[model samples]
Target: MADVKVAVKILSELKSFVMQVASQEVVLDCFRRSNRDFTRNRKLPFDRLVLLIAKLCKKTLSIELEQFFKELGLENGCSVSAFTQQRIKLKASFFHWWNQVLWQSYYHYSGESTKRWKGLRVIAVDGSNISLLNTPALTKHFGGQSNSHGNFTQAKTFYYYDVLNELVLYPRIEPYRYGEVQMAYEGISQLSADMLVIYDRYFCSYKMFALHLWAEQPIPFIIRGNENQRMVKEFITSGKRSEIVQLAPTCPAIASLKKSGFIITPKTLLEVRLIRVELEKTVEVLVTNLTEANGYSDDQFKELYFLRWGVETNISVQKNIMQLESFSGLTVESVEQDFYATVFMANLHSVLIKDAQSTVNQLSKHKKYPMKVNRNKSFGKLKTSLVSLFIEHQPEQILLILHGHFIRDTLPVRKNRTFARIRKNKPGRSKHRTYSNYKPAC
Candidate 1:
């Protein structure tokens, strides 16, 4: 089918890039901690190590290794100790670079099919906490929080997620103490004019607005503002649906901007549009540089702002479905490796299932509710075929096989799903269980 060809072409592009990365000694050397690393051949070579990490290792190390080798049709495999040592020699930045470049490849190959909103990519910016192992090395590198019960090791992460495309274009992991706004500000340079970014109330800041508006290309953005914000509160008091207002930088924002090499005074003003959207019971204000009333009207603001939820859902998928915190190794390097690799795997899974999703949409048009590919089940199928899709010669056949599996397993698309949030007084670490002897063979 035509869908299978598109899947094959994308997989082949990724395979070629992976091969190019593996074969180039100059590129491989950059990923190595030392020039001596991966210089000689070993059971777990540089190329195999890269692919193995993308496998989403979630079981006992010994069992995962055995299955990985068996999938490659190899009888002999390296020990868990060997994998630990090999991974440490390679930097985690490799996976980060691989993820970014692979996303670029998807966009390049997807062409006109790449989703967009009003001639711009709908990007959502959000931050989340990732629980890290309680090892001294991890705790020392990435700080955690201490409460009445005990100390919990974790990391703060900021993600630039393309909501419409269902891809994480950029991901940043920092120490738990780092601020998300500052992390987001650091990502401003990577923004392009063709992106319209949406943010939640936590990211609402004068400095953030100034950076986006003052950028060379003037990146368009919409940020939800809380009722507590002075600017938002004033807008609500006016009882206007939408208004364009000037925002002056506060002393703290000016100081923060100065540290980032952007000199701004309190007098510096940013012209932003504020829109008020009424919820079922409460009202929320949105701040954005998109002041073109004709193009982006007040009514459209609600749905535009709601798009920010995509990043939150993506984070949930990463943590719950992908088992992101279920780290294979406790060292800082391994943690970083697993984190970025998980992002890559998530994107890969998203790209691979697009064809099946489209087919489901067409077939279910006459049904009561539209249907979608069951992502959890699709992920399992993709994981089993990941090695072959990358290493096997007949990727088209493998893709067709996956397409069949994907179309057969689907779930109905339920809309407007809501749940009440339960607030916990004391924060607790996410509990993930992995048995020592019991591991799934499939």
Candidate 2:
């Protein structure tokens, strides 16, 4: 099938990049013992360790070390201690670089322009909290939130999600005390002039707007405005659909900008456009740098603002489908490793499923209700076939197996579905159980 060939080509290209990274001396040095000779005793090479960790990330159930190695076809595999030691030495940057490589490769080969909106890649920004095991190191590094029930360790996760491509650009995990807006400010550095970033009202601040302008090549952004904010109130009172307003920097904003190497005075003001849209129940205000002269109209802004919901669904996929909260290790190092590994695995799945999705859409055309691939089933298949896809000499055969399994099951989409928001109380930490005993209904 055409889908099978596409999947094979994508995986082959990914494997080639992974091989190139593995051959780098800097990457190989990370796995070597400090005192060991670089030329000799290369027991667990960079590629093997990377494959091992990636396979672990894809599993639904926790796998022990010996069984994992045996599954990898290593009868005389290294000890569990050796793997752990090597994993510790493998810095988080390795996975970051790996993700960048895959993204660039996908961008080059996939001809993905259909996913873009009006010649712009729409990136959504948002933050969520990820629950972690209550260990001393985890609690110390990630911190926790306390309720009447008790305290549970949690980490703040920030995502720069590409809505059109179904890919995550930058995923950062920080201490629970770190504010979401602060993370958003730091994330601005990743943007380019061509990107159009969208944010929820929580990130609407003068400093955020200033940081975007301070970029080497400033990028465009759209952010929801808090209804109660003074600027929103003024804009609503003006009785205009859209307007460009000058915002004077606050003292704190000036200080923050100055510290970041921008010497701006408090009197300096930033000009941004404000657009108002009326919904069924209430009016929504959005702030953006997009202008009417650029062919960005008020009607277009309404639809573009709703695109932010894609990031919300993306987060749900990470938490509910990928089991991001169910960490495998108690240490902070292991937690970081699992976090980035899961992100990498998610992107890999996106790349593999890209071509198959079109085929799925075609198959659903005859049905009364349109359908899409059941992500749960596809992820399950990926978990079982991933190691073989990587290690087996004939990857085409494995890719075919994956394509056949993935396209078999599809779920109907219910259009215009709406549900009332439910606020559930947080259960106490006393109800927590070991991850091994817990099974998620995917």
Candidate 3:
């Protein structure tokens, strides 16, 4: 188990990094210029406003503006309209840079071995849709899904998740009409040779595969095969466990590569290995660049593919546990701010629980089943204590409180648990109005 003192030190480092960014001269100057009351004193400073937004993002329940400002110690709190104006003045880039800073600091402090898989960082790529409030601004910016009942606004979110570390390396939001494949291609630009990307069948295409291979470092990837594809069909018919096949680029793929400064001709064929695995009801095909000669065997591919499920669970945590679909504001800027802030808090929560989690695992070794920290409980405790960790003079007291609560409540891990998938249709709202004529029975 990791030492509590070490964990405290890491938290202190994170606090220092946040303070450095918030207190930068350039950042302060930018805020001063943005504020209408630059010459007059105000209750809400730039750093305070940023911290307040961060706390709101982590809060489990919706907080009214009056109560929120009262908790911040503003006796005569600013009005809702004034607060909205202040929030609009702040740029979303501030949160973006802060998240980047936090990510880089985490990588520096946390050892590389903690996040690496066989000397490579394993990353998974997937996209999900976040439901937004039915507002005209939201509909105009993010679009919406249509049904027979009505139209509901939604925003498409693409994530590049670190499967081993349980962290979102990058997240992008676009309109609902945006294609996942296009967003995925944009995500590929962030890859490096030291990383191994895993993808679902939806991302399996000639252009996608070629783009990765053509990178300067040539990122290694494993993508589930689409059975209808010609190469995949041929490999499956051959009944070979593994074989190398040549993929001919399409005209559009060739043009894309040429535009990206890669010299390729019509005769150029890219070599990729195809691995065939038989499951209970179907034969699964995987296309990857890793080879047997390089020490990657057929058995290892199954385990590697299973790791991709971590990203799916990560999305579940965001949507269900964090309540990511609940927006604090209706504007596009506010939506973007909330999105990045949620990601930052998620990463922060992971960092804070590392030591407690290790301790719990060690203590559970003699029990009937292995136990893990209850995430919902830990998140709640963290939310209650988040502001104190930053603003209080003695922050170690708050950290100790968080550590104690996190180690107390733990859930047992039940391995090999399976259940039939649930399929349910979306529920529609009732058309009848209840507010005008309804009365309480009492």
Error of 1 at 91 (Å): 0.8
Model 2: per-residue Cα lDDT over 282-386, one tens digit each: 888999988898899998988898999988988877776777777655678778777877788888888777666778888888999988777877877787777
Expressed as tens digits, the lDDT of each residue in 130-177 for candidate 3 is 988888999999997898978989999888888887778888788999
Error of 2 at 223 (Å): 0.6
Q: Is candidate 1 or candidate 3 better by TM-score?
A: 1
Between candidates 1 and 3, which one is better according to lDDT? 1
The sequence of per-residue lDDT tens digits that candidate 1 reaches over residues 1-442 is 6545666777776777667766888887778888788878899887789899999899899999999999999999999999999999989998898887778978887788888998899999999998886889999999999999889899998899999999999998889999998789889999999999998888888888888888898999998997789999999999999999888888899898888788977788888899999999988999988876548888888988888889998998788678888888888888899899999998888888888888888899999899988777888888899888878887888887888999998888789988798664654444645433223333
- Give Cα-based local distance difference scores for all models: 0.86, 0.77, 0.76
**Lowest summed lDDT window (length 10), candidate 1:** 433-442
Off by over 4 Å in 3: 1-18, 25-40, 57-76, 259-263, 428-442
Best by lDDT: 1
* Root-mean-square deviation (CA) per prediction: 3.0, 3.3, 5.1
Q: Model 2 reaches what TM-score against the true structure? A: 0.90
User: Model 2: which residue pairs collide?
Assistant: none
How displaced is residue 399 in candidate 1, in Å? Answer: 0.9
Judging by TM-score against the true structure, name the best candidate: 1
- What is the lDDT, from 0 to 100, of the residue 236 in candidate 3? 88
